[model samples]
Target: MPDLRKEIINILDGKLLTPHFQPIVSLTHKKILGYEALIRGPSNSPLHSPFNLFTTAERFNLSTKLEFLCREITIQRYADLDIKEKLFINASPLVLLQPEFKKGETLRLLDQYGVNPRSVVIELTEHKPADNYEIMRASAKHYRGMGFEIALDDLGAGYSGLRLWAELLPEYVKIDKHFVHSLHNDPIKLNFVRSIQSMAVSLNCSVIAEGIETQEEFKAIEKIGITNAQGYYFARPTAVPVKEIDKALFAIEQDTDCKSAPFNNATTAVQIIRDITPISAKTTISDVMNLFHHNSELTILPLVDDNIASGIIFRDKFLTKLFSSRYGIDLHGKNPIKMFIENTPLCIDKNMPIDLVSKQLTSLMTNDPAFIITHNGEYMGVGTLLDLLAEFTRQQIDNAKHANPLTLLPGSVPINNQINQLLANKIPFGFGYFDLDNFKPFNDVYSYDAGDAIIKAVANTLIQYIPAESGRVGHIGGDDFIVIFTCDDWLTRCKNILKAFESTVPSHYSDKDINAGGIHTENRAGEKCFFPLISLSVGLVDPVSTSQCQSHVDIADLASEAKKMAKKIPGNSLFINQRMAAKNSGNFQSFTHSATKLHIVN
Candidate 1:
C-alpha cells in the first residue's frame, strides 16, 4: 500500500492520468449539451480508477497535487480536442485551501490552451466539509467572477453539500449516483430528486442527473423535468468524447417521459409544494412568527399534529394579526398556532388529481392563500394555485411540441412514443399505418394545394372514423398517417376509415375525373396516363395477435410490408399483417388503366 502511494504520486508527476470525456445530453433539446471531463490513471496500474488514484494520493498527503494534475490534464486535453461545449472539471473543495489554487493557474492554462473560462464549470467535489465556508465561498466566487461556473458534485452522497449549495449557490447541482441508482424502484429517491430540482429552479441553477446507466433511471429523471443528463445510458466515458452517438444509443428518444408520470395526478401533486418546509402543530405562535420574520420567502406553514396536517396558516395573515395589535404578541405569542389557523383553509388530499385541484382552486375565495396537501391524513406540504398552473402550462407545452403542425394531430414522435408505452406495458392494441395511393400523381396534376387538401381530407377521415376515446391519429409526414386503436372494435373502425376514404376521395377530384372514375395525369418520367381518384393503402398490424412486436420500428416495418402487399392490389385496400387482406379484386384492371400509368407512394 505504501509503495502504491509513491507509484500514484509518480504517475501524477509524469501526467500519466489522461482525461476521459463523457458526453452530457440535454433531454429537452435532445442534443449534446456538453462533456464532463473524467480523469483516468494509466492502465494496468493500481491507480487506474480515479477512485483508487485519488484515495491513494490522499493517503500519501498528495491529494491536492493529484487533483490539480487531473484538472490541468482535463483542461489541456479538452481544449486540444476543440470541444466547444461546456467542460465540467472536478475540483475537491479541500484543494481550494491550497496556495497554488489561488494563483489562478487553471484559468491561465485554460487561456493558454484556447479554452474559454466561460466554457468551464468547476464541479466542487466534497467528500467532507470544507475547512471554512467563507474560504469556499470566496474561492468559488473568484472563479465565477472570471466567467467560470460552479457545480456542486455528488450532492446527496457528500458531507455538507446542502450547506455548500446555500453558501456557494453553484450554477449546477448534480444529484449523486446513489440518488439516481434504482430510481425507478424507489419513490423516496424520486421525491428527493424532485425536491432538489424545485429548489435548484428557485435558485436559477440546473440539475444534472449523473451516473444514469439504465433507461428507467434516465426516464425517471426526465419525467420530472431534469433535462441535463450525463450517464453511461447516453455514452460511456472514453478518452475521446463521443462526437457522434453510437447506433446502440442512437435514436433513444429523449423528453418523452412527460407522459410517463405516474398516474398523472399522483405525480403532478407531488411536484407542487415539494419545496415548502412543514412545521409541527404543537409549535407556539412565537416560534412560527420568528420563522416567518426570519425567512421572508416563507408563505404557507402547514401545522402538523403527529405528521398529520392539523391546519395551515398563511404568513401575511399571521403577521398581520400579530403586528396590527401592539400587545398581540404579548397576549398570544405563547399559544399554539392551531388556534390561529384559518377556519376555511383550502385543504386537499395529496391523492387528488391536479385537474381536480385546479378546478377547486378556481372556485375558492381569495382569502384561501394556499392549499394544504395531506397524504393519509398527514400534512405533506402546501401548494399554491400558481404551482398547479405552472405544471399545467408545462404539460401543455410538452404536448404541443409532439403534435403535427399540418394536421394538429400527433406526429411521428408521439406515434412512436405511445407505441413504446403500450408495448412496455404489454397492452393489446391495433396499429394502423396509412398511406395514400395515387396521391403523387394527383398532386402533380392538381398542384400542391390539392395534394394538401387530400392529406387534410385523409386526416379528417382518420379522425372521424377512429373512435375518439379508443383511438389516436398521427401524421407521420407527407401522405403517411398512423392510428393506434385501443378499442376492441379497432378492426371495424379501420374498415370504416377505408370506406370513408374511398367514398370521400372522389369528391376531391374535378367533375370530369368523377365522371371518368379518376383523373388523367403525367407522373414522373413524363409519361401520360390515367390515375384513379386518391385511395388509401392501410397496413393494419395486430401486434398482440403474434409474438409481441419488438419496437415501434418493427411495428412500422411490418405494417409497411402489409401495405406493400395491399398497394399491389389497386384501389382502397386494407392489409392486416398477421391475417387476411383485400387484394386482387377487379378494381385492379380499372385502377391500372395501363401498367405504365402506375406509381407507388407511402
Candidate 2:
C-alpha cells in the first residue's frame, strides 16, 4: 500500500545503505591485495543487496540517482585506505553513461574523499543492455585516463561478457566461481580455467577466481593457474574491515596439499619387444648382416629350432666369420638355418628384474651377448636398457603435444584433429569463433605480454562455456579460438561461453581502463581518440545445408565473415551465418563488397 519506491529513495538519499568489504587475496603470497566493497540496504530492509536495490530503482526510473548515491558513499567511507591496495566499487553500464557521471565530477568526488582514481577499480556489471557500448566505452576511456581502473565483473556468466572484454580490456579478470567450483571433478573445466589463466598472462592482466569455497575447489583452481581467489570458504562479505586473514592464508598454503596426492597416485606401464635373429640360423652371411642392420643394438642374435632355444651369434664374431669365408657371396642362397647350432641360447621374461638379468647375462660371458625374452618358448616381447630409455623419450613427446606452450592447454593440433575427426563422421555440430575486439590497441598501449594474457583469458572463457559432451576447443593462434558442440544444445553452449568471457575479462586491466570501459589510443592522424569498445563477435555456423554442400574451409570462411560482421555492430553481438538455402547460378553478392564471381564446387 505504501509507496515502497519513494521510501527506498528517501532511505538511499539519507545514505542509509551500509557498505561491506570483502577481501581479494593474492594466491601467490597469501596476502590481501585489496577489499571489494559490497553495498547492503538498511538492516531488515526489503532491498538487502545493491543488485536488488538497483533493479527495483530502474523499474521506478531512479537508477541514476541511486548509483550516484551509492558510489559517493562507498568512496567516502573507504577513503583512508592505503593507495597501493585496491578498492572495488560496482557500477552498471546505465549509471556509467549518465550525463551527470562525467569524468570531472567523478574525479572531484574522489578528491573530496582523499581517494585517488588509480586505487579505485570500478567493477562493470552486466545488469543493463550493451546497446550503447560505444558511448560507455568512451566514458570508460576518459575515466581511465584520470587514473581509475576498470574490471569486467561476473565473467563467465553473461551473454555479452566476451564482447565487453574485447571492447574494454580490463586489467584484471575475475573468474566466475561456477567454473572454478567443479574444476577438480571436470577435466574440461580445469583446462578451461588454465586457458583463461594463460590469456590473462598474455594480456599482462591479473586473474582472481571467484566463489572458491571448498578446499577441493581452491586446490583445483590453484593447481591449474589461478593466483587470486574470493568466496565463502576464504571469507564472506563482511561489514567490518578485516585486519588479518590468517584462515584464508592458511587455506591457500594447504591448497597444494590436496592437489599433489591425486597427481602422485597416477601410474602407467610401458610395453617392450625382444630381438630373436641369429647368423648361424641363416643359410647366408648376408642374412646375419641384414639382421644387424635392422637393429643396430642387436649385439647377439639367438637361434631357435623345434620350439627350443638354439645357438647365439655375436655381431663381432659373425662379421669375422663372414669376411674370412671365401664363399660369402655364394652363401647368400645358402640355408644358415641348418648351419646354426641347436639348443644353444637362453631366453627370459620381459618383466624379469633387470638386476637379475644383468647378473645372469654377465655370468654367461658369451661375448657379453644381449639376452632375449620369450613366453611359452615363443617370442612375446623385449626389454633392454636402451628400450627403456627410448620409451621414456617417447612419453616426453606425447606429453608435450597435449601441453599448450602458452597456456599449457593441449595444443591446437590436438584440438583441431579431434574436431575434424568429429566433423568427418557427419555428426551434427555447432562451431563458434571467438575473437577479442579492439585488442590491437590494448596490446600497443599495454605491451604484447599483456595482450598474450588477454588471449589466454579468452581461451579459458571459451573452455569454461563448453558443455561436458561438447567437442574440443581449438586455439587458432593469437586471439582467435574455435569451440565445437555436437549435442542438441549447441546455442546454449555458445551463449554461455560468450557470457563467461565478458565477465572475467575485466580483471586484466587497471581500475582506470576498466572504469573507462575501453582502451585509449591514437588514430591514423596521430590525434588522441577512443576506438569502439572491444567485444567478442561470435559467428555460429551450424551443420544444416552446410553438412551436404559446405566444406570445412567454406564453413570456416563463412563463420569468420559473420564474426567480422558482428564486430562491426556496436557493442556485443552474435550472428549465425548459414549458407544460402538456394545456390545462385550467377554472380553472388559479397557481404562486404560488391557482387563478385561465384565458384561452384563440382
Report how far residue 454 has shifted in candidate 2, in Å: 61
TM per model? 0.47, 0.42
Worst 10 residues of 1 by lDDT: 586-595
Model 2, TM vs. native: 0.42
Query: What is the lDDT of every predicted structure here?
Result: 0.72, 0.63
lDDT of 1 at 408: 82
- Tens-place lDDT digits, model 1, residues 1-602: 44896688689778898889898776533467788888888897878898888788888778788877888888888878888789988876667776655567787788788888888988877676556677667768877888899988888887788888988888889999899999889989988988887787557677899989987787567656675788888899999787865523422321122232221222346667654677776789899989988999878787654554545688777878787764288898898776564332445556455665675567433446576675543557788877888887886677679777888877777577667766765666777788988888888878899888889998898888775556678897899898887677876777667666677776788898888988777868788888877777777777453236767887887678777877876777676676412222212111111223333333
Model 1: residue 427 alpha-carbon error in angstroms: 15
Count of backbone collisions in candidate 2: 68
Task: Give candidate 1 misplaced runs (Cα > 4 Å).
Answer: 99-102, 130-132, 244-602
